[model samples]
Target: MTTIPRISLSGTNYEIGYSHGSSLKAQIARQIEFYYGMFQYSSKLDREGVHSRARDYEATILKLVPNLHQEIVGIAEGAEVDVLDIVALNVRSEIALGEFQDGCTSLSWKVTGEDGKTVQYLAQNWDWVRPVQQNLALVEIQQAEKPTIKMVTEAGIIGKIGYNSASVGVLLNALRAPPTDTTKLPVHVLLRLCLESRTAAEALSQIEKYGAASAQHILLADLSGAQCLELSPIKHHYIYPNSDNFLAHTNHPIENIAIMEPSQFPGSKERLERTYKLVETMSSKNISTKQLREMIFADGENGNFGICAPEDMCKPKWFRTMTLFNIVTCLKDGEPTAEVVFYNGSTDWIDPQNVVTL
Candidate 1:
């Protein structure tokens, strides 16, 4: 089994970034190199154009979230690399999908456990470049006035997926749509904002406020309930749980929104349907965290719709995608705990309790 490194950071935003970059500088360098190759291959763009685009994206990020920009700068300084390289990774998803086309899947639900207690569960399989798995790190960030965050992210990127001490957890899936205004917050930065939120409502408000540059789906869950938002560049659609208190989403937009376009990954529809069916079947019985983890790694008939991506299916020669990691976060006794399975083509999951707190 492969081991994912864990990093702990504290203090102001810059301080946290410096700590994060200094500790993982080598990984950051490799991550940037890998992404540059990806950009070159997928977008067919030359090096000069890629750097120019990264700088433009960096300017947008600075305009929207200046503090995040400071953090990126700190990371570049600490890692002894060009800030544009870090910025490239920060907005890689957008650049990859918009100019190139890339995408992930997530399934979440709130159900009554065997003890008859309402439990919120979220599981995600992050599909991306296989090499990126090496850059993966479990990061815990502590700030003076903001909510402490624990997230699974790439070496230089600020946030991707994770929960906070305030019992707030966020998971995301990529969506495809026509491009819109670039000034809005990118999805990854919005994810960091979600972690900063102390409650589900606050997270929703933050999403509504900044919106997104492209298309993405976010599942925001707290101890009380969970919500899924399908965000296109032009509009946002909100989906609440069904009467059974279950919600699930894949890469595609389920809601009938005008802004949503066809999913780049057609497999997303199958994944979403299979996920919903599995959750519904599991909800009929008493569910446990262990069972939840099993469901994430479940293989469908012939391994078609399984939550875990098969090695052969994850052929880097084609899509440059793989299930880099699987994350399951839950709230127990009003506290957030997370278990992560760093996909190493094996079934090894790590549970670290109390790693994130309010």
Candidate 2:
């Protein structure tokens, strides 16, 4: 029998990363790149103008992994054939990538294939003081042997990776920088590029290196508190032991390394404020995961900000989603089984392995 790469999260010990399926990397990448291309690689967003930011993403990738193009570019090229078709395939629910902030503290998991396995890690959240900015964030550690789960995303590769083995996926809105020759090297090209890896690290490397798009953060977590690094072109890494109980993220580029640059964006502030508000609610003694779900899905109008796109996201033809989530198989042996919820209000979603065991 073939031991395929099935992404199941069971108390941090078990299988993850590349599953036995048809081009897991390409399937993941096509979903993202095609959407960007369909929308012509632009969003109705203001602040953090992305067209110019594309260059920054390219530069950052070059610095992070200079030889990435040779390793994963082929996957990106193959996916291009059906990117447009695939983008049009699914519009029922947009792909989202994230984890419950509270559920993912201090968990570890591993993903194995024909090659050696890689560990996915998580510590408590922290704060960061970058060269020009500062913020609070959670901490996670993992390596990339085409890292199967623990990794950082590149610029312009919006919603970058971590979706190959789980139902959770994230699609980002590119705030590209200016001075771009948008004629040939648009950012949409990179989304397809990112989906070409079996691990989070591999996807991250692909996006960062070949990323021609502009800037956006790409941090995703599975249900077990396993996290990935999302290095934006303009980063502002934060420190740990913050107060987010439920899994959450904003525009802030979080890194504990202290070498990241400062990020400047109104969206980052807004998302941070929103995250703080969530933390407050979760920290309450009475708050439960159900309430946390409500908070995530809460909104003022019928179109709930609860799992909604940013208020400024007005592009009718863009990758619009509320409460984007990605569940990876990054759990180590000591954590709990992974599960997720949708609309930030549903019951926890258990993986198939847990279901079978139950």
Candidate 3:
């Protein structure tokens, strides 16, 4: 029910990291500690091996995005934690899924009002360990020439989900497929790239250029339009909105037509079905922001089948899956203005105006 902390960083990437670490040292430490425990509990690998694997990821990330690498190193020096720990947090999806499984739901739509003006909206619930709530931080990054970016992320992670000054927003959901080389770009990094993009098409190109290390579903929205991207280590797919101008996706792959391997998260289909049915009931025109919030927070029968996921429903307590936060962004045309509502385990939403001017 409390407000999530916010941190602002500007200047070069290294300077940004230094500023982030200096401002949020304690929260960053807590984040690293929590992930270490979660990794140990969920995986068969020992602590030493896990740290080594993190170092391997560090190498891969640096090769993929050297700027992010410098930022992470600066953060490590300022926060006084091992650089590998930060790398582990950035790639936590890959490491955690080595043994544990989790889920998330994303939905986006365009509604036309009676006046004929259309409003674009995207909303999602980031389901993860309840304990991660303590590490949650809203980060605003300002660079020299690149687009200014804002994201809600864990303390040590560079990005998870957020929009940018270009009015481009991204929502992420985990997808399960056969594992590939851990050397490819991680999915979280791809999410960051999407935020850095100026247009939805550019974001899709970024995913195609780098390719994802694991399976993932990325929903990208901008003033122009929105698109859903399905990516695995080896293949990729694109899905457009249905006739209703509505799109909903959970953890599983639903658009795959070619013969391929089965998904590891079969339960995702049920969650997707629930979301689709709920979205179908709403009016295609004039779907207000209030209605979007209600849909994201709605619970199914006995809290069993809805967008909001409870802790008890997460099987094998060690996985720690729960709805950590819900984000709803309304993009306005002709300017970089967006109305964002960030709900952090509370009925009240954080006002974007209060946090950042953009």
Candidate 4:
């Protein structure tokens, strides 16, 4: 009798001082598999449900040739890693959470995989970039349970909206490369991993991941809270939790690093300062997680979007957002239910019941 071999997918789990709870962990693995299948056959995914428009943008990622798998050390499962490496934190810095409470998340940085690392993919999608800037939009992702609306790019992959049973939603933008070594893990996977963590502290634990290569800004929030900060450089990875704020992350050089640490990216620092300013000044009216998405696309006025005066970007501008995304996830009490959302322009939300495959 011959048996098949399974490969291990490496990922880091960070935490302030908590766990993702047992039930949620199991559910996360299942959800990951579901998202993978959906991603692998996204076009069919939307249609299999009810009135689907998957063909609109999801078709791109669904049609994407899985090229990064080549660098991995094992077989594939359309989307590998049927597991989740998570992190948890007890508290965060108010300075960090200040960004979202106000509006906009534009932290930036970079990542570098080690010599013997096995990376899965290296994809960079500037939802605010050219070619597709003409169609900055958002829509609802119809699922069976409830709606987990999202904002998507013309190409998909970039999911920035919707909430699950937890009333928790996030708006993520690529500040830099999301590590694929599995050892260090990808930010998307990590952020999605955070979705599974029950509380803010629980999810922080889900972030303790390996060191590889990557960087970016996460404008995360729930009905109760919101945060925006940079993913610090890998080599000098550190976690700092304080009172007042529950969680706070940034991409610049952390407070305490060895003398030989690398320098922070110039653009990243500027974005951080600007983010602080945006949060401090922006007004809070007609600002739902959905509307803030416009900031990610084309904010005619710099009220929320990353448009206007100093176009903050690395050569790519149009898609750059003060809030270049509109992803939502409907979770109950921070525990993920059957709802998930990914948005771009005016993406609607996805209902929980709809995500289930009959």
Give me the overall lDDT of model 3.
0.74
Higher-TM-score candidate of 1 and 3:
1
Q: How many residue pairs clash in each candidate?
A: 1, 65, 0, 103
In model 3, where do residues sit more than 4 Å from their true spots?
113-116, 257-267, 302-305, 313-317, 335-358
lDDT of each: 0.75, 0.30, 0.74, 0.30
TM-score of candidate 3 versus the correct structure, residues matched by position: 0.89
Off by over 4 Å in 1: 98-103, 114-116, 260-264, 300-305, 313-318, 347-358
Judge candidate 2 against the unseen true structure and give its global Cα lDDT, from 0 to 1: 0.30
In angstroms, give how far residue 227 of model 4 lies from its true place.
Answer: 4.7
Residue-level lDDT of model 2, residues 1-358, one tens digit each, is 1112223211111111111012344444534444344334334312223223333433433454433322223223333433222222221011111110111111122223122433332212111111001110111212234322222222112223333333222333322122222222233334433433544445455555544322333343333333333433333232223333233454434453422323343344454455455555443343322333344433222232322332224423333323322222323333322222211222332223322110
Q: Which lDDT value does model 1 have at 298?
A: 44
- Give lDDT tens digits, candidate 4, residues 123-148: 11132322223333333333333323
lDDT, residue 163, model 1: 93
Off by over 4 Å in 2: 1-71, 74-215, 218-239, 243-249, 252-271, 284-314, 319-321, 324-337, 341-358
Which digits, one per residue and each the tens of the lDDT, describe model 3 over residues 178-253?
Answer: 5745778888888888888888888888888878887678888897778888877777888888887778888777
Q: Report the number of backbone clashes for model 4.
A: 103
**What is the TM-score of each predicted model, taking all chains together?**
0.90, 0.40, 0.89, 0.39
Q: Model 4 residue 285 lDDT?
A: 30
Per-residue lDDT tens digits for candidate 1, residues 1-358, read: 4456798998777888898889999899998777788788777766676788887778888987899898999899899999888888888777777443233667667766667877777777777656677888889998887788999988999988999988889998877666745677778888999999889899889878877877778888888788888887778888988887777777777883755464355477777777766776665446765676566444433253345665445445536455666677876455667777665564443343312221
Q: What is model 1's C-alpha RMSD?
A: 3.0
Error of 2 at 262 (Å): 15
